[model samples]
Target: MRFILVNGMALRPRILCMLCCEPIGAHYLKEFSTGLSFCGHDCYALYCGRWISRAEQVKCPAVAETSC
Candidate 1:
């Protein structure tokens, strides 16, 4: 199992995919942790609301802004 160091603390190894729940590939952000495992780089960007050069469907929508 792979481990990630966050603020000097070791985070438990966990799968990044939303289906099988296994860490199959590299993570986008080192500190941010999520259970959603993307199938590919395209899927990763789509999952994170990143715009690609080509036309592709956006999976996860951006969060709504809120005033605190």
Candidate 2:
């Protein structure tokens, strides 16, 4: 979390996705928290789909059969 100073102004840097390694947008920023941020809605959903509670996993269908 570093900022650059130019012309007496500060600027924030772009954040990368935890999965895809791409720039994150404002819509995805809503998911940013606890030092964990995703790139998009689908990225966040897929993340949740993986770490779902075992008891509730049955409710959420598998996003992928195998991890790639």
Largest TM-score belongs to which candidate? 2
Top candidate, metric lDDT: 2
**Candidate 1 residues 3-64, lDDT tens each?**
23224333346436443344544443231344444434444544444333222343333322
Clashes of each: 6, 0
The TM-score that candidate 2 achieves is: 0.46
Scored against the true structure, residue 17 in model 2 reaches a CA lDDT of 70
Q: Write the per-residue lDDT of candidate 2 for residues 2-58, one digit (tens) a residue.
A: 111124222247677776787765545333234566655676666655655542555
C-alpha lDDT of residue 59 in model 1: 32
Q: Candidate 1: misplaced stretches above 4 Å?
A: 1-32, 50-68
